[model samples]
Target: MRRSIPCLCLAAALLAPAAVQARVAQARIARMHTPVATLEQVQVRLDWAEHADSGQLRIRAGRVDAPALGYHFRDLTWTCPLRRTPEDGWQCEGALRGQGVAQRALALRGQGAAPLRLGIHFDVDALTATLAQGQARLALERRTATPDLTTLILTRVPLVWAQALLAQAWEGASFGKGTLDGRLAIVAPAAAPLRVSGPLRLHAAALQNADSSIVGEGLGGDFQLAYVGSAAARVTVAGVLHGGEFLVGSTYVALPPAPVGLHIEADSAGAEGWRLPRIEWRDGDVLAGSGRARLAPDGNVRELELQAHSGDLGPLAPRYLSGWLGVLGLSGVELRGGVDMTTRIEDGALVEVTAVVRDAGLHDPAGRFGFDGLRGDLRYSAEAPVDSQLQWTAGELYGLEFGAAAIPLRSGDGTLRSRAPWRVPMQGGSLTLSDVAIRPAREDAGADIRFGMALEGIDFGRVSKALGLPAFTGVLGGEIPSAHYANDRIDFDGGLTLHLFDGTVRFSELALERPFGTAPSLTADIALKGLDLARLTEVLGFGTITGRLDGSIEGLRLVDWTPVAFDARFASYPAPGVKQRISQRAVQDIGSVGDSSFMASLQGQLIGLFSDFGYRRLGIGCRLENQICTMSGLSGSAGAQDENAFTIVEGSGVPRLDVIGFNRAVDWTTLVQRLLAAGKGEVAPVIE
Candidate 1:
């Protein structure tokens, strides 16, 4: 075993002189201490025939400990024949056995348990030793002529054997699995810096730091490493990693099957920090980059500069960008593009960025947004003004497709501003954006953006069709005086206006949160005035009603575009120029949807005799919260005879018919189902 080699050499050196003077010689050492190791209960015996060329030698030790080297052995024994070569050099080769040798010793013992082989050759100026078990070998050589130098050769060696050596360079670093085949030269002189230089071939190697923030698995590489340990330590590594995966914080790299070249040179910044002066990575057509960075003692990046270009980004998402995409809630987003970029950071803040994009495209599989044919050069600076331009051929937002547009921008003093208004065509109309300014996020602040927008002649029919809603005819045109975005939320300063069914609809106090993330939410207040009820009902597939309509929806909130809470009220009032009439089918559908019963001044059975009815006024309202709708009708207060009864319709002609609802509170879902059934002409009237 490697642990006991030094003791064997010591025993041979002490006894070689005695062997020549006497045929049989023995020595017992209760305890012996050396600079590298300590030995206890050691015994040595040599037996030689008179005038013979060789002698029988045996050495045993109860314990050997080298705490500095992380080695401890117990019950060590070696039996070999000692010979004096023609050159007057000593040689020994024999079986070596020991407990607590290393992990490999345990593995070798489990596979048939053969004693290890140790061979030693030493002269006045040089010494060489080799320890082997099975097919694995470790050799050490030192020379008195160069007392400061030691060379080690390893063949089929388990990486665990170097755990202590690795810790000397990176404290608390541990080997998980793998093997090594390489050679190393160590220069460690008294009262001087220790230096190690080596070339190593690793197979399926794995390792992790104490906190597990840095991890590698299934790593295979051929590398050249040089490290110097001093007040300002330096390390250099150059290699080609063939296969593996590693994760450092939010950045995860899944190496390709083909080899990727890497090189880095770093100097110690502090007790636990590093300053990288140069770094290079090459991965064929998938990626290539070079960068320099400074890391703080707490492992945060303090300064960085990088220049990178990708020939193709189709494969970059799953392999290199998954971590960032997942953290931003854009997992599974697809990309096809080529990009070149340069970035710089100082004091943990981005100071400048420049990027050029070529025929790029991105699509979210969740159907939120998509963009194609993007060509641009974008430049940003925190200290100086920079001008840039960007253009996209087409895009889609919430399923509404829009045609191409270009944007000119200038950035300075940490703010980017648009130079000209942007007009995008959509659904037979245009959306114009102006007065745009943006500021990127900093360590202490979130992103801030402000913009103004105007909509002109947007066809609501096409909008409804695109959104899979009822085919309502209208024109949308509005101006948002200002809009601001910050902290993942957007707020509009003004409202949108739409002309629908010969009336005007307004949306105010509009705000949105997490618009592009999971579970987006929206809140707004809506008001409608003088809407043609006949046209509105016809588009909704409800039976005909000729009247004027007014409504308001307050405290409206939707999560994932589904109504969660609102107070909505709609009413019909007399119009001097418009006739107020309701058809029989409309009365029946309204009764069914409102869960009301029909009452006639003459008789309930005679209500079916009339094909239509005249109504002075009608109204309905509901305050929805917690999945319940508190229903109200024309009679806003409780009825004198029945507390729950409320008049839904008031008749004004002969044989007048009125609809009365007895239920005041209904499940929102049930009310929606009833409305849907009525719209489909599946509900029948109840007469009382």
Candidate 2:
């Protein structure tokens, strides 16, 4: 009987497991959903199934559409086998695993009734709500109308793990493996202010984006944010940046390392809705700036007191003013030496800027503009003009070198004006600047200026040599009463006059487009009167032609200072005591227009016999466009419609020689080659 009893007990013990397992029922749900469920953008969907006997409810194919938060959760499954811990409580949760920052393994527990209480956890410690592994502790107190102060406390959570929270703040936010440690209290009540307060810290952070616009590396920061009023508009924030390199859409600011920190304290109150009363930045001992700024009624910077000291301008320019410098085509401009400046703003306008640079020097990568040993004291005031003096030991403009000179300046009306006319020596002559005003570059691209220039008598001989052009003997002078600079373009309102070849040549309507950038353009209208052809031809080596020449070149455009297009015409001025003669070589050079057949019938063979011929008149015109030159001659020949009957050198007396142009349209490039060939004495007489 005892053996039988033991056997019965063993059999019962073995059957107990099967009996307990048999009582558990599992079911898959299908197409069962609760419409209009709240909790932001979460959609609650469940498959209908009756596992009521087993106390289990499985939810499958759950998805949340949160487009506003830039998030999508798919492939979601929740298994909530009902337990008797609470009469109407559910432990519905699943491993949310997929792409993006929302991927996580969570266990959610909640009650199925009103005034709902829900809790979600990733990795929790024995201490009920100790967050870990991107876990969050959330609690909400609610009523029939709305919820109040939904508290969310997270610890040791990856910063990027809060994509939904971050998406509500900014676009395309990318953060690194930094842990977020903080408790955030938020309230969303109807007809009440949305209040949020928290002490947040990001540790060991390195954040960057696909576009280099919002990039920060090795960033560590803390912010104590408190808001008891309406949505963000009335919020106060106190933040401190320990160290980092922050790049915000073309502007990059970086902090060095330890005690060198950057602090920000801002509030929304007073005359201005928001103002920064304590803004400080420190970079070791090399750079430091502390300032306060108040926002205007429209939320722009209205008042400010900023003082900056830098041991080197080389780094400061790139870190702070790269955007503005790039607009001025001065990127990669090297600057060195100590710089100190104090600036003030009033009503969103610059009030004053007191700056002093010591032993400063600049090296331009473009080699167009640069200065060395620059010492300057600049005091600019909005109300009254100040005495500012600028001195440089050496300088270069457009690759031209000049000695050191002190330039005096004054300021008013948001412009820096020259106090007196300054003489800049160039080409053994003086270059004077008067009425010079300059509006410095700012963030909004509010930079423009107007100035006047007067050149006394600049020798063109040295100017020609300096410019690498043919030796020209003339006195260059000009009066530009209003040279305006705006939108990267400079236009001269007056003209420059040149006395050369016993004549006058004037240039008007001159403008320089993108003066310091790629392919600068110069446009002007040039008029010449009563010019000696002998001296001109001798200087240009264009084969001696003795005659008084007058010409006009309108709409002349030069790109990179090289003539690209023009409508030019030159002809005998018909003045007293002027002999019109064309050298034999010159006749051959001009006859090369058609060379053989074009000049054959026009004394081509006879032209080679005379050393020089007396011509009744001489005329030449070229209308260049689209790389083609439309050639013409004197009024009589210029208007000649016969294809091969345009006279170039009209004969007067015996031993007559008449050179004519037969082709009206010629390739400018080809004509230039021909002209160069003729200049080299390569013109050959082709007799047919």
The global C-alpha lDDT for each of the candidates, from Candidate 1 onward, is 0.83, 0.64
lDDT (Cα, tens digit) per residue for candidate 2, span 409-489: 988877888888888776556678888888875658757888888876778887777667788999988888889998889
On residues 1-688, what C-alpha lDDT tens digit does candidate 1 reach at each position?
Answer: 2424555665665676677788778888888865455789988888877777778888888998865455677887887888876666788888877776544466444566666778888777777888877777888888879977878898977777777666655667788777888898877765666677899899888888777777889999999988777768788999999888887766777889898999999898657578999989998877899999987654567899999888898888877888767656677888898989999999888899999999999999988889999889988889899999989999998889899999999999988889999999988899999999999878798789999999999999999998999999999999999999998889998999999999999999999988877788999999999999999889877788899999999999998988889999999988888988887878888887777887777555677887778888888888999989888888553221477777888777876778787787889899999888878888787777
Looking at model 1, residue 200 earns an lDDT score of 85
How many steric clashes between backbone atoms does each model show?
0, 2
Local distance difference test, candidate 1: 0.83
Q: What are the models' TM-scores?
A: 0.81, 0.70
- In angstroms, the error of model 1 at 77 is 14
Worst 10 residues of 2 by lDDT: 121-130
